[model samples]
Target: MITEEYLMQKLSRTMSEKLLRHARGVADTAEKLAKKYGTDPFKARIAGLLHDIARDFDDNEMLQRAKKYNLTVSEYGFAMPLLLHGPVAAVMAREDYGINDQEILNAIALHTVGSEYMSQLDKIIFVADKIEPNRKHAGVEGIRRQANVNLEAALLSCFDESIRYVLKMGFLLHPTSVKARNSLLVDQGSFRK
Candidate 1:
């Protein structure tokens, strides 16, 4: 198990204070979600602590760092390198922090753009990143409440919110997020919203 002290030591050396605070918030939120949803809270907390390890990197740096890893950048990722932070951080989490759990790595990598087939831990980390206490947005509180009731529903709301944000910014909406949202709706057998 990765101790909080160990994570803080590693993070403090590479992350900004603001980023550390966000990571702490995500860790706490992920643990709570994992406990609520009957998953491994330890994995959730560990993934959360390391999820944004490369978030402070600039756009070019994000791309550069990703190349050093085993990951391939998607078309959307090339267009928006900001999305590469998760994948880059995943590599860092594995290499620098010596984390070997695929579940935690996937959670870190998928937290930014989400995935079509998200594990329970993946959903926990993803939703926790959005609803963590340090986060502030329009419908975040509603999403937080929704997360406690239904993880998938909260994930759907998050997808909806992300899509809305992309549209608002006139950015390309990544198909992965769209597919993820559609998958949730399809499973639910409705798409009224």
Candidate 2:
């Protein structure tokens, strides 16, 4: 089992100072959310810390790692190589960090683009990544407020923001994100507010 300190050291070596701070912020937020939602705080913290492990890779490096790991890359993912980092990070977490927990791996993998049916841990990590203390997006406060009342509602709000941000940036929307949002809307039985 890899210790949290060891993971932090690994992250320090791989990420820039700003990114390391962001990872710490995510980890703290994820740990708190895990406690609030009655999940394992340790797992949430670890997953949050490692979620962006491969984020610093350049386009070619991301594509190379994705191919090396045999990940199924979507067209948007190819265009936006950053999207490939999540799955690549997951594989790295397992192989290099010796993190064998599927829930933790899934949280790391699905944090950027949520899954169809998000587990509680997945929701925690995703929300924490968005609403961490360092994040200052326009809708962040609203989602943080919703996070206190309902996990799913906050997740939906976060996803909505993500979709809009992608659209505004002229980036192709990843189908995984759309499907995750659709699943949440269906599960909640509601449309865009």
Candidate 3:
């Protein structure tokens, strides 16, 4: 039940200009992807705009807020509380913005690490977050192109990109991400399960 004007007002007042810019970019990207994928563009935009509502919070704050929001954090989330931002913000979108749409909320929640079973809307937001104009990385343009053509292809690319980055950075690859990528691979019948 949130309007674009209201969402922008809340985000701008609390978030840094940098985060706001990223949010806007994600919103635009999500909307475009949603339209292309036959999902609701308004819902996608709302989810995208609020996806990172808690991204800037400090690590401890993320942990605390995760509990306050009643999100059960995994060991991975406890170790890397940044992962909790998505879920925390999903709750914020519900409690603060009065958004009761589970689909939009799930898209926001899983945008960080991804889930094994993702809807088209979830795939759209995840891909949009990575391919948004504000994002910069190796092969992002190619991934963006893939997103416009195929959501699952774009999702696989995004997952591969994330895995590569995590390996390069020596970070533990979250299991959810692994399962998500594997789910797609299995569905394609290309990987031995």
Give me the runs in candidate 1 sitting further than 4 Å from their true place.
none
Model 1 lDDT tens row, 99-183: 9999999999999989889999999999999999998999999999999999999999999999999999999898988988999
Model 3: runs farther than 4 Å from truth? none
lDDT of 3 by residue, 84-152 (tens): 888999999899888899999999999999999999999999999999998889999999989888789
Q: How high is the CA lDDT of each candidate model?
A: 0.91, 0.92, 0.92
Candidate 2 per-residue lDDT over residues 1-193, each given as its tens digit: 6789999988888889988999999999999999999999999999999998999999999999999999998887888999888899999999988899999999999998888978999999999999999999998999999999899999999999999999999998888899999998888889666
Candidate maximizing TM-score: 3
Could you estimate the TM-score for every candidate?
Answer: 0.96, 0.96, 0.97
lDDT measured at residue 1 in model 3 versus the true structure, 0 to 100 = 46
Could you give me the TM-score of model 3 versus the true structure? 0.97
lDDT of 3: 0.92
In candidate 3, how many Å is residue 143 off?
0.3
